[model samples]
Target chain A: MLEDKNPQKTKLEQLGEFGLIKHLTKDFALQQKSTIKGIGDDAAVLDFKDNKAVVSTDLLIEGVHFDLSYMPLKHLGYKAVMVNLSDIYAMNATATQITVSIAVSNRFPLEAIEEFYSGVALAAEIYKVDLVGGDTTTSTKGMLISITAIGEAKDEELAYRNGAKPNDLLVVTGDLGAAYCGLQVLEREKEVFKVNPNSQPDLSEYTYVVERQLKPEARRDIKELLKSLEVQPTSMIDISDGLSSEILHLCEESQVGCNLYEDKIPLDPTVIAACEEFNIDSTLVALSGGEDYELLFTIDQKDFLKIKGNPNLTVIGHMTDKNEGAHLVARNNSKIPITAQGWNSFS
Target chain B: MLEDKNPQKTKLEQLGEFGLIKHLTKDFALQQKSTIKGIGDDAAVLDFKDNKAVVSTDLLIEGVHFDLSYMPLKHLGYKAVMVNLSDIYAMNATATQITVSIAVSNRFPLEAIEEFYSGVALAAEIYKVDLVGGDTTTSTKGMLISITAIGEAKDEELAYRNGAKPNDLLVVTGDLGAAYCGLQVLEREKEVFKVNPNSQPDLSEYTYVVERQLKPEARRDIKELLKSLEVQPTSMIDISDGLSSEILHLCEESQVGCNLYEDKIPLDPTVIAACEEFNIDSTLVALSGGEDYELLFTIDQKDFLKIKGNPNLTVIGHMTDKNEGAHLVARNNSKIPITAQGWNSFS
Candidate 1:
């Protein structure tokens, strides 16, 4: 990431606090009219006038969330913003502004931080969201990023996890399990690199899966697409901690049950091939392998015709009465309880 | 502080992610009517109707922001919220909600996290702000707290640091430097404890100063007081770094200069006594000592009479033409150019 040929590093202490903040955030241009004031103030001011405001925050820590050995700092920044924005999209709101805070150890030079912010700026621009205020400071260990995304929507258009009905058709936007397979590929490459420092592994075949893991995009377009298709999800959530975990959350909150069809679960061809190559079950990976920033929601049965045969969406499940319990209908016609074996940070 | 004599420990891995979050936040009641939804959703939803929204965030790293050796986890939690809320109050807005995301190492038990959340709950209750949303995750090192405070105010009632015009009166709420002196006392005690673990140092005389460091309160009431007194600040900021640094921020943002009076700077008797004991100049302590969490603001000349004799408010300076530059009027009536020697996290 260091493009400077001289390789002479400038320490963060040399720039001081204000100078560093100004340098890192100078290129961010406020885009949202709701953002009355951005950085350079005690707090960012937003005038959401009549729109209901939505707020979501996430914390990404090094070693636990991402390994810098394979993950570039630029992609890390982009992924951080995307993760928070995914939560906003789950609320069926238009993501408008975000605050990016970071705490880094002194080992990282000014250029490293600049590279990270460049990624953040790129994500903000691509998402059409304004970069608002945030804090930067020192950390005792590795870097940690905390992002809070703010969005706006009308009261009626907003979606909540508890709005599902018994007949709601469960749906997921885009394909899943690619990010997990991508992570597996990266881990294998890292192991190979450690054993032989000069070895260069060809990653061209795993390009799609690797990109999914490294630069997963939040389903920002899903909300607008659903609007145009006239399908309003009764309940919604982002698939962060895997599909099974999020489905269970929706069922529990809505006081209903879900019956997911294993055969209907969406998966990219790359993910299927990688699953076979790694001798792992693609169904299990789709159910429990997390980090896929896809939108998972349920729509009323009446709206099924509107979303039927949509290439970007798959109806993998349907809501049922609470007594039915959450389960998956396996392709072999056997029933299995859906368990949340998603990634747990603590363990 | 673990007070349970039995000392039975519960590992975080036992509860899992959802259980941990629910256990920590179960007692947080929504106090604000504006909080349409709190936890149990992808994002917290708020209906502000017409009031402008304000957002401020802060990241408090364990070693970088607070030394846990002397800082009780409860007080650390309380101070973390106060630090973020102070920024909102600086905007002349009432803090209504906060999202506190914490990343903790595996070393911290459930009870320790409970103690910290108790402090957070206490602050939220006392301030009448709702604990709307947050993310709790595992870190590779010590604990880090990132708090995002959301507040609201009418567009016309809001204050920004760039509103001060020439001839505006510089005002501050409460005393400064006590938090800094309080840190000195704590550090000295920590050193003493390091030498002899069994030694119990007498900190009775330093009670006020030490408490200022351990549990500093944001001036939440000051905003209400200004409204009640029919006075609005032309420009405002919270003193997180130091007086000199915050003054320079207002000066730079407003495109004006300031002349602060050394005599008018507010200091408690405890701070003065502690400064003498530490063999440090009280003026320098007041100027450069950070983490005061006091409000520094400017008022139009007509409002000066309203705040002049108020014990809670002190007029320390006035805005001047930009060419005059920011300076401090010493006790000897000498002019000294003020420099921002605020606490640099990098250093």
Candidate 2:
């Protein structure tokens, strides 16, 4: 039989990313009653007696993910912890614990790791997440950092990416494009430093933008504000892959359309200034600029009145029927479709 | 004033691995009631109401961790799953779930990942760990693999590295050194194949040994057998870093020493034959060879009688007081001091 001549014996270079994940997870039937969700979304949901547990993970590698020359270990540690915790906050859950793993070669001395952990422990204490469990090992090239964050939420409070309805008001927290601009600024500074080692960086005005990239904060406060204000978002996602990509995610999951406003879109002055300097569109930065770690959500019109005057929440647009299509209302009232220009690491 | 000169910014390579862990983890305060233990153990323990939870992680890299040139992707996937579950089994707990993360470049296609995942799914089915969640991304270099495993156990029934007591029987389950020897054989075969690709590898006699290195099984059966026989080990650890090293870990934690019988040390017939052919001492292999994935545990004298005649159990030696020092009883009844030749990833 042709089946006897197994075709899979070839090297893994033939399978690609999606094929591998699909194959590895085909047989993983969720056996736990508490596992309301498993691996399909931003975070998996577990139904505990009092609250649902939300879990997420992120991996950071030196060189491939970050450059030690520009990326400080402390920021790297803090940023790693923040990225995973942000996934929990995306579901409006309060992050409670985190497991951090580091694999480094003898290339890094004890002090280097201590500096890294000092940042991790500092972030843990700041976020109130217990430094739970992790593994330490040696690598041939550089350090590998992986963090898993776990959070808890009541069943009523848990948010999903699939519940948006037509006429639901779209709300985004804080501003977008600042973090994206922050990255451009850092890259420019790095390039300038390479050419002139004696030149001092005149980054006196981009403090907020730089911090947004280096030590981005999870929207833990928004969860509390929403609880106090009694507003539950029907659908939500984190701004990890920029506003455009995140909006695309919400559309696909909810199987509905969106109509966001260009004028109402939040943009910091620094973002506008940096956009001009980089000769890139400010809207594109907001659309495709990632690593903001902000929350994007949709609120029912009924709760819009309750959340209208709230400073932390800003209304950007509304959801629509699937056939209406996902679009953006430009400044001149021109309509255009929304799309994701996410970072394709493979490319 | 000296603190202002913070040497905390020193390069990571200067502090080394252990120093970094100690520095980063020092300030972590355990806040969860369920966290019976955190880091600094073979595995972290989470005390649930009905059962305890065990957690551990390990990272694999390109050149340092595994050479894909010789290691098949399926075998790599299998080894990754086996190593994590092995830690849970080390805690005398049943592994429940695991999260696997991978970083690959575009050089890999879709079908190759399917082969890797197929292997992972196979192991999950055999071990019954749900493939909870994972992060997939691209790396600039070779592939990176990270696996985290979670387990469940009774509060009082859990075994720790520090629980061995004086006069307790120091017993090791299954055979030792075969996995390490198996690795050596594979390395040799790989080298030979490089010299002559058309020449067939004569590994038929070392089939079991080679398989042990590629796809070692976590002793899930041992946990059930011990439970059915009502034998609760006072102390337990897995043979990932050789017997002498594991024994030292038990003694260091329990604050006790031990003696083992050289003749009583179990060796698979294949392992013994391979060691002889390689001109390596069988006793040394039994002592220092690791990755057996067999559970090495100490049972109190009263509990030893239940397993005395069982084929799966062996009465290798007994734990002794701290003053006695760790030693092994030779075939001639002479005592030889035992020194740990454990896996030192840091070096």
Winner by DockQ:
1
Give a tens-digit lDDT track for model 1, residues A185-227.
9999999989998999999999999999999999999988999
Clashing pairs in 1: none
Error of 2 at B323 (Å): 3.2
Write candidate 2's Cα lDDT for A1-347 as tens digits. 11113443332223322233333334334444444434321113233444544557677877766777767878888889888888888887778666677776545554465567777777777777655556566666677898877666666776777778899999999988888788878889999999998999988798888888888888878888998998998978888878887887788778889999999888889888988988999888888998888899998999988898777788999999989888889999999898767654544
lDDT tens digits, residue span B1-347, model 1: 44334458888899987899999999899999899999879999998888999999999998889888899989988999999999999999999999999999888888889889999999999998999999999999889999999999999989999999999999999999999998998898889888999999898999998888999999999988999899989999999999999999999999999999999999999898888889999989889998999999999999977887999999999999999999999999999999999888887
lDDT of each model, Cα atoms only?
0.92, 0.74
For model 1 the TM-score comes to: 0.98
Please report the candidate that would top TM-score against the real structure: 1
Ten contiguous residues with the weakest lDDT in model 2 chain A: A39-48
lDDT computed for candidate 1: 0.92
Q: Interface root mean square deviation of every model, in Å?
A: 0.7, 12.4
What DockQ does every candidate get? 0.91, 0.12
TM-score for chain B considered on its own, for each of the candidates: 0.98, 0.84
